[model samples]
Target: MLPPFRPGTHLVFFALLLTLPSQALAVIDRDALDTAVVDAGELSRTHTLLVAVEGETVIDRGWRGHATDETANIKSLSKTLISALVGLAIERDIIEGVDQPVVELLGDRVPSDIDPQVNDITVGHLLSMQSGLQRTSGSNYAGWVASPNWVEDALTRPMVGEPGERMRYSTGNSHLLSAALTEASGRSTLALMRDWLGEPLGITIPAWTRDPQGIYFGGNEMGLTPQALLRIAELYRQQGKHDGEQLLTAEWIERSWAPRTRSVFNQDLYGYGWFRTELDDTTVHYGWGYGGQLLFVVPERNMTIVMTSDPTPPSNGSAYLEQVKAVVERMIAATVP
Candidate 1:
């Protein structure tokens, strides 16, 4: 049996209450949470579920012989991590702000014959997947990764729409950001992540897949333990502070959560790498990865949740993702007064 959730044990929640007068912490029903965790185990695709309320871990469970500490491919949740790196880069003046033209950062890597509109795509457009490039995900993903030069190939892909015009949902946009970060910082994205996020958060960030150019695969194939992902969610829940230090600015968190585009598949609003939606009538922000890896933050409840699943199978339109959301909804319901 899980222990009962105590609301005021953590100073973080108390600090948040000072600014958010509209929200009151609720004592979570441990039994209900336990039931939710157990029910989550019944889902064949799910591997683990961790829920923290008011900065206190209330439930951590692993199913199908999987352990929460084992590293798993976070898939496109890597996009969210990349998004954080972009914020850190801008904060440190490694690159300019989001409005900075991506071609300026790419320099020689920008293909010579590419569309002129490529010059107009800003860092923000790539962060929000509005790069206007034909998608390198879905049916086109295999070909893009197999190409000789990822950065040049992605840049040369025909423009599908105007930059910042619509949400196109392409991994190519994120890969370009990875390349830009690599060129602008003069360091690999892995090194930047280790120095900027891993050290401060005290989490092990294992290396994941890289492209032909040895740049870390930007928006997908990164691996992280469930606990590590929870730490990230908590960082955002604390408004980019960790252990009393401002690891990422609160301003970046606001901008990251601000709705910049909407997902055509689910209609959830996309903000940078995060997704915005409502869960049980409470505003929720989340980072969703392929095959059900999820990180959810509920500011009103001072909660962060992580769920990891088998990455081999596709979860889109499978109703499996909805099942994962239902599990989170149960956890949210337990927090209601």
Candidate 2:
């Protein structure tokens, strides 16, 4: 005979069941991903490649003597983490909202005689790389880093266009967000990161670079182990929840995945911290870093993927990224119908 239901018993049962580790929603054709890695020769340059389906890691491997557990510089992928922190800050009331004016946040830090256009920039502008400030990336990168104060240098740059007008793709914009987070929360970005994400996701976040002002560098040079990267991607794939904990609001995830602009370099749609595109009939939201550090989330398939490459070599517009995409394509196709 079956046990009779009791008041709240079903709820308790469901809660207990939810604590069990997640299982794959669908099987992946492991051989396909394996063959793709070999055929593409990604092993030579790629340090690690990982794939997770339905919150369970199915494939974890490293190449060229690099261990999958080794922390690798994620480059511009740091932008994605910074963007996530921005969402958490808003949720925690650290800042008002994405519409909060940049100048309002930075009061006295505003550079002397800064272009008036800077006042109109918002947190959203920085998140989407549409701050209208001349980019501090590319050829401007060395000079920007050479400056004594990263935030002040970024603010002092002349506005090339009005805020929210176009995607400028600058590390300067991310650095400013990092600075804002520090000022608004009265905590180092690294501290907030550990408390907000690293603790929740059970991932280690080691300290990265900081500006001359001691603010953690926001958009560049952050490091994470490939396994940790997979967990982060899985967090987004699950709509900002992990093991029944809502780290980020589903609404914010939707907003982050929604395309607000387009990347000039690749023409891919840009959301808050993710790049969006449809590959092989499956939508992909991704974080890309220099030298081929990549994290991809395919929500429709309940899958997350990470690829780490040599951070020292140049990969901008290089064949390496294309090969990374090819690997993704293979993984996407491996999804069981």
Candidate 3:
């Protein structure tokens, strides 16, 4: 026959087991976050930083008056938005295909000097930053922006290499894309963004800095709130869906995340507008701009991280990736559900 249970023994055993492995992982370490906040306070990062995991609030601290709700220029990160817009355009039949020769669409806007190489460049080449056109921005940025016509100025650059033979990170290619979109839709790039993305996502473009030509600066200089950025990351995570609506086709997102270029710094493969890195054997895709602006999305971990700052000495994208990965590892340790 079984013996009768001891009065308090069952209760103690259950309590011990509850704390062992069945309990949910803590979402974050408040103390560790406090240290991060303190560190942010001491430095002059361009703006606020926000981190989120699995829809759980992990770190939402702001320093130097930066907050989650505030928006700042995301710089070259805007290129990704432009890329997504192209994907949406493809889905909506705004254009026939990525392989379409861009010169035929630009009409009178095509360059007067018109290198034969331009004929060889395709929409895909531009999107992939392998257009082979001399980069429009550089040590020459000041001069380029000083021009009254950004599109024309960008087109005038020399073709230093054969099209598709090399990868060059150029704002010129993206600006040309904006012009291409303008010509294709008979609507401004900004208008197209509003009709397709901004409205659907409920995200008003916070602000977009423009060039002398008054076109939205390509490849750089756009502003967005932390939540707004999250919405973008989430959009990609869901393969271009927004709030249950299919804004961009799953195929486009797949292509965009697919490797088209390699990271300029570390040989990490780059997609249409995002960088893919292997962290702890898991693939991580992210976006980084000139300053310290970073947006990381880890599908496997169901995690997203965004950091913005005009660091005193410029933020290193790779190092920041490691920092975020470490913190996310801890957060995963304590994740609930």
- Candidate 2's displacement at residue 266, Å, is 1.1
Decoy 1 TM-score against native: 0.92
- In the range 287-314, model 3's lDDT, one tens digit per residue, is 8776667777777655676777764345
When 1 and 2 are scored with TM-score, the better candidate is 1
* Least well predicted 10-residue stretch by lDDT in candidate 2: 9-18
Error of 2 at 270 (Å): 0.5
Residue pairs with backbone overlap in model 3:
25-334, 46-309, 46-310, 75-221
Which scores higher on lDDT, 2 or 3?
A: 2
Tens digit of lDDT per residue, candidate 1, span 86-205? 999999998889999999998878888999988999999999999999999989999999999999999999999999888999999999999999999999999999999999999999
The TM-scores, one per candidate, come to: 0.92, 0.91, 0.82
TM-score ranking of the models: 1, 2, 3
Question: Scored by Cα lDDT, where does model 3 land?
Answer: 0.71
Candidate number of the best lDDT: 1
lDDT, each prediction: 0.88, 0.84, 0.71
